[model samples]
Target: MLKKLEAQPHPDDANPLLRLTNLDVTFTTSTGTVTAVREANLTIYPGQTVAIVGESGSGKSTTAAAIIGLLPGTGKVTSGSIEFDGADITHLSPKEWVAIRGSGIGMVPQDPMTNLNPVWRIGTQVKEALKANNVVPKSEIGQRVADVLEEAGLPDAERRAKQYPHEFSGGMRQRALIGIGMAANPKLLIADEPTSALDVTVQRRILDHLQVLTEEKGTAVLFITHDLGLAAERAEQLVVMHRGRVVESGPALEILQHPQHPYTKRLVSAAPSLASQRIEVAHEKGIAVTDEELTGSGAGSVSTSEIIRVENLVKEFDVRGAKGEAKILRAVDDVSFGVRSGTTLALVGESGSGKSTVANMVLNLIDPTSGKVFFKGEDLSTLNSKDLFKMRRKLQVVFQNPYGSLDPMYSIFRVVEEPLRVHNIGSKKERVNKVVDLLDRVALPRSVMRRYPNELSGGQRQRVAIARALALDPEVVVLDEAVSALDVLVQNQILLLLNDLQADLGLTYLFITHDLAVVRLIADDVVVMEKGKIVEAAPSDQLFDDPQKEYTRELIDAVPGRKIQLAL
Candidate 1:
């Protein structure tokens, strides 16, 4: 159980630990200078947690970068006064910034893969932070690294510290970054979407640890995220940014319950909790839900026929232990499930719970150690090579990271048209027309065909990926954390688009995700996994309304801001 900390004094009643006054940040490009943050002001008192909430390009992150003195590429603070702990730090020398970085103000960035060095061991990187900050003597640094990792919720810390970044899952890497950020015992911590990549249970654990830090050490936190629910639950003060300016700032609950700005109103309505409410209301009324509902709850009745079925699925991997001894790790053990035609089955679990592994087995991307996967009443393992090749055309997948999944070198047209070309599905001119139609269906402009994936936003890139997946006209489309990385607005757009596509195309979806709120909105059925086994399975409405297992209830409870009373 998480221990509740004593109430903190309101921000207005206390001296500010960090303050930003009339801040204006700009970036100079080849075209001209563009302001990223304009006349923004914020405050954080000691032991107070303040959140900056906004969309993807709303300048929340830019404000955070300015605070840390690490604004990227041609960006500068043109006008602002930044005061930290009674000291003016608007403009500091490189040496001065270095001296204050870890010891005074630490940061936990959003993407762990990019923030962490790929070639270095995790332990070495943590050690470097301690050494750079001079937090401890060299002799004690090794033990400190283990302690930090363990505190961040990584089990077997000594063994995990020796692993590289690639060896850790997304949640594990994020935890390691948190440990590094808190290692120096800084007076202030800046967490940028810190728990976005984590599962609800793990997110609760990490946030609980941070709350303990605030209670014991009086460390102030400047939390930055696109999640309003998280902002409402974790912060005492909320600063809402839109189009490079602060549109609203006040007590977290007050702003959330009675949002003043139009943008803030949109954010509150688009949040997953409210979206789920819309779904419930629609079902209760027996009314057809429109795309505007953003709940994806109108995908027609599920067929009795099973499009995909798995029985006694087992997957195992051989790995070396801390003592260098070989052992077998069963990733998926006796997992069994079925997806009916024209319906969405959500495979939900925390990282390393074997959900993705099960998806891989279903797709035949990897061979299972035992058991069978049947598609259309045919066993997959028994198919010949030629038959397997033919079957692959009916199965498609959209990976989690749009930036990684979409090739950088390929134009949008080629990326969508490649599947058609590989299967010899159509002529050159026909494929061109098909690609254009697919792009339109996913809500991208026809002109986007000429642009590359790197030029588009995360949401646009995902639309392109969906276009590619549909290019094959597959029977089952596996979405592996497809909308997990996007902001709330973009996520709602993508979910609505998916629902429209599924209804129109009669697509069978195997949606794999760790977010139960999203599952509540998009999934028709839910399968809960933990430690490679199924703990519960039920219809979406039943599971969320009356969860049978403790684990399932824990996940539902862990959803941020579920208990908050919103005006919507």
Candidate 2:
């Protein structure tokens, strides 16, 4: 039996800083009225840190949006009262919301790409927030921006301030968003999946700064995320939401140790932390992995023969700098690796580490400046345009953002069948049948075939993308950050599906991601990259158990839930 973590005592008589009573939120959609949150009740004390965790479409984000009065797509609170600091502000006007938007309630939205305006410079955006809130004097705004950026772990803050969103990497953009969200030092901070795109080391730094908000500034934090293990480690209290209702709420660790709700139990079991623990124990016991231990697949028996080999791969691009001077930017330099047949080779690194650049080269999406790429011992450079087009059918790719990758104009049936249509392989009826089978393989229902990309959730969109990738019956698949945007449970499902597919079809995978925990769950070999160089390359067990490089060790230690052992 797992021991329960002792819950910290709270002052029962103290007034709550924020309280939601019988909160019912609904959205007016084309189909009909949809209830997002039903009779929800929650309370947060001043300076307290609480987490709301669940899979996508579970209403955690919806609840956070409601608190800030920024709910999307005609969502409104009905027959509910929201009291903040003893003030009933449930139905605040737009002008009224402006007064509390920054100074009283700060929000760090998910997806830095869409959150930050691309045309504006980093400092300009931060200064706009500070000026709007009147948090500092006009003369002191510049220095304040630097201070917040530095606090968010951006080095050389002055130089970085002038850079636009496009110039910054994914991690750097997230840091900028954090700096903007924390500029006014609001009373309450709502961080919605802020660090989901960041690597472990950067994630640790951002999380540490959030801890400072509660400890030093007496600011309460309402964290919304899909990683249950992360919520268990960071927050004092936890609320698990399933299908828009709170299924369980209690002390964070207590919920993990002894979850009463079936959904909560499923979440606890599906966490990558528990999977890593199982891998660690198996390695400690010197137990050879069996087929059952490897997600009902032959993932454990991946052969050692090379399927795709990259040698001295170098890619460079010409860029015009601030002064209109041409500069050669080396994206991938002298990097080399090989993916074994019927196995997963994970390329692990932070943003701008050239992981995606390498994947692009392997897929022949871009021509390399130098070096050689061999697909099944045949040089990619040697193939003509006709042969290259034919060879591409044997190689497929699933990208990070499925919504962006899939065309919105196309329905689920069109999206999955387009590849088949382009290949000229099947009749109209045959292609329709193939689309249904592919959707079934990815666990999507037949009814979804009529829906557009916007009609489905994030996980569902990713499944459609996977189904499309497998439509051509490719020999190799490149999954680039494929499951990073998903919650833990969805990520586990996708990883398991990939494993089963690899086992059944003997497919090869080139997995690229920043998450080391997920890499441990599904990867056969790991290649650690930094600044367009291979820092370390080893088997999954060796990389996790006995990493030889200091950078690798730092990344492993920075995993969010590494401190606590999950119950198996």
Candidate 3:
């Protein structure tokens, strides 16, 4: 609602590059119809960064798709006008859109793997992308491709361009995707969750490139993501969406630093990577949580009743070099920790620290060459398949991307019923009843029972996934980056839900994450991990009050916006 009034025209649009007037996107289903975008009006200037922020179901990406004429087959822009520099381009046929998609507008899809042809060479694909937009003469295509790759900040651009997509790591793949997007230098770039899959360092590098390009070429950006921190770091303008509607829209700083909306406030409070800085500050000032504050803040009711314990856990992996011999990469080396019943033990670390490996071993998904995992004082490794299956119900997990974890083909009902069906623990009637009850507990409607994963938003899918994980009534829930991919507001809601569930169900948590902000909010005890080893372990209060390890201090220092004095 804010930007609609006073924002200046973007420098790149040349002349009001594109505009969406009273846009309405809808879909017609077999049983009924749904409106995905409601009177969504927008005016994007060339060379400006317009951040579309929202929870999973916020209709942000759908709006981007509509602008690009890439809506799903079942969906349609029933009533709206999409004008490119004053030309009404809303209803263009697919063939007509083909000419415009790459030349006039480019899209960097959310998942790099989804857009790229895994089998093709990266250079060849990039060359094709450039050629499709008629960027250069056929003779100069190869050189042009090299330039684009270098501009994208890839190492050994020429050599990397020759490699296949699979050869690139997650960060590299995203950069390669950016290379393709920049190939033709389209007037507008629609980046759907471009940085969601990247580490912070990589994310910062990529955003730097995007900023330079915008300033140099005046390319307007429509960045779609669930990360509010990222949106603040990059975009000048902001648009917040929820339940397929815009709840707030304004300058990025105003919305992020001084949000008036309740939803927006919650999102800011829940940003784990950012909010976790509270713990570091305490350590810096050597301030301990007082008895009254600890009790009031949730530490008073907690006790050290170890449900899971790891003693001198060691995990290693083999890597091969040109010599054709293997080198051991110690992923989890001599790590040790304990989880108390009805409390969370947070694992905080950087990428490649063996946090996930530790989680997998605890889940018994992977075998540890050495070390012992004691569950309820029993050796986990000694359990038989039958007993292991039973043990699984006592410990469950929630992954990073809820959408990817859930099957797109199955309805919410079937997805939630999976644990019951797998264990064959209940009758058909009993399972159905449980499914309905779990859905209600997760705050999802019964109407979603027949709805598929694709039909739900990011937050809704996560809720559905949470319900599924809770189906077995597990005592210990392993949330592996569970709230990492969500927008600030939705992430906070889920965290609160986890807290409530812990109180109601008497649950224990082995929360593995790179997000320190989460450690401040939910962790009863904290484990600082590095390269698969526990560098520090203490009660949350003590750890935050006085962190002794240098690595712990570094992790505390790495959080973005922690030192920045923000208004809100």
Order of candidates by TM-score, top first? 2, 1, 3
Count of clashes, each model: 0, 0, 6
Candidate 1 lDDT by residue in tens digits, 122-202: 999999999999988989999999998987778999999999999998878988998899889888999999888788888
Q: State the RMSD for candidate 1.
A: 3.3
Error of 2 at 138 (Å): 4.0
Candidate 1 displacement at residue 483 in angstroms: 0.8
Error of 3 at 134 (Å): 2.8
Q: How much lDDT does candidate 2 score?
A: 0.86
Per-candidate Cα lDDT values, in order, are: 0.88, 0.86, 0.80
- Winner on lDDT between 2 and 3 is 2
| Most lDDT-accurate candidate | 1
> What is the per-residue lDDT of model 2 for residues 172-271, given as tens digits with 9 covering 90 to 100?
8888887888888888889998887788788787787667644677888899999886787788889999998998999887898789999998898788
Clashing pairs in 2: none
Superior candidate under lDDT, 1 versus 3 = 1
* C-alpha RMSD for every candidate: 3.3, 3.3, 5.0
Indicate the residue-level lDDT of 9 in model 1: 60
What value does the lDDT take at residue 561 in candidate 3? Answer: 47
lDDT score, candidate 2, position 54:
92
